[model samples]
Target: MMLSCKEATRLMSMQMDRELSMGERLQLALHLTACAGCRNFRKQIGFLRTVTRKFGDQIDDS
Candidate 1:
């Protein structure tokens, strides 16, 4: 079964916090393959996560 964009987005956000089950991963991947918006959302969130982690690391170093 395909996931809705809302569901896919939720899964993507949840992914940052925890590991997704095989079923959730498969569904989100399928949705992302066809949905450009969700794909972009995933990329943006990933970029934000990277930046946030680096910022946190810099703060720790300070």
Candidate 2:
């Protein structure tokens, strides 16, 4: 089922933590496939996660 923008945005938080159930994950995945806005949001979150890890590594290397 195609999700509305608001629903997709709400899923953004759960998606980031990989906390959604399999069905919910599938729904969000399908929604994201056709929704560039949500896809970009997901990408942004992924970037944030990467940046966080880099910062953590820098601290560890210090």
Candidate 3:
């Protein structure tokens, strides 16, 4: 079954928190291959994760 953009994006978000099963990874990859918008979203989120990881501790939590 094809994953919709919403589902794929949710999986993408989940991936940042923990490991996904092989099936979930495959579905997200398949969705990203066909959906440019989601692909861009994937990149943006990836970038955000990287940035936060590098700077998250530097920011003061209020």
Candidate 4:
């Protein structure tokens, strides 16, 4: 079954912290292929990760 946008997004975030099972990975990949919004969300998450790593303390918490 194809994943809903919400489920795909949840999986994308979870992927940042841990590895997904093969099934989850497949689901996420399929969802991203079909959903442009989710693809953008995934790209944004990746960009945020890069920025955070580069500017850890520079980004104010508050």
Residue 52's lDDT within candidate 2 is 90
Candidate 1 residues lying further than 4 Å off, grouped into runs, are 56-62
Per-candidate clash tally? 0, 0, 0, 0
Over 1-62, each residue of candidate 3 has an lDDT whose tens digit, in order, gives: 99999998899899988999999999898888899999899899999988888896788977
Q: Between candidates 2 and 4, which one is better according to TM-score? A: 4
Candidate 1 lDDT, tens digit per residue, 1-62? Answer: 78999999999999999999999999998898899999999999999989987996677644
Best by lDDT: 4
Q: Which one is best on TM-score? A: 4
Q: Lowest-scoring 10 consecutive residues by lDDT in candidate 1? A: 53-62
Clash count in backbone of candidate 1: 0
Compared to the true structure, candidate 3 yields what TM-score?
Answer: 0.78
Candidate 4 C-alpha lDDT tens digits along 1-62: 89999999999999999999999999899888899999999999999999988996687978
Q: Which pairs of residues clash in candidate 1, taking residues 3 or more apart in a chain or in different chains? A: none
Instruction: Please say which candidate is ahead in TM-score: 2 or 3.
Output: 3
In terms of lDDT, model 1 sits at 0.92
- Give per-model TM-scores: 0.81, 0.67, 0.78, 0.84
CA lDDT of every candidate: 0.92, 0.82, 0.91, 0.94
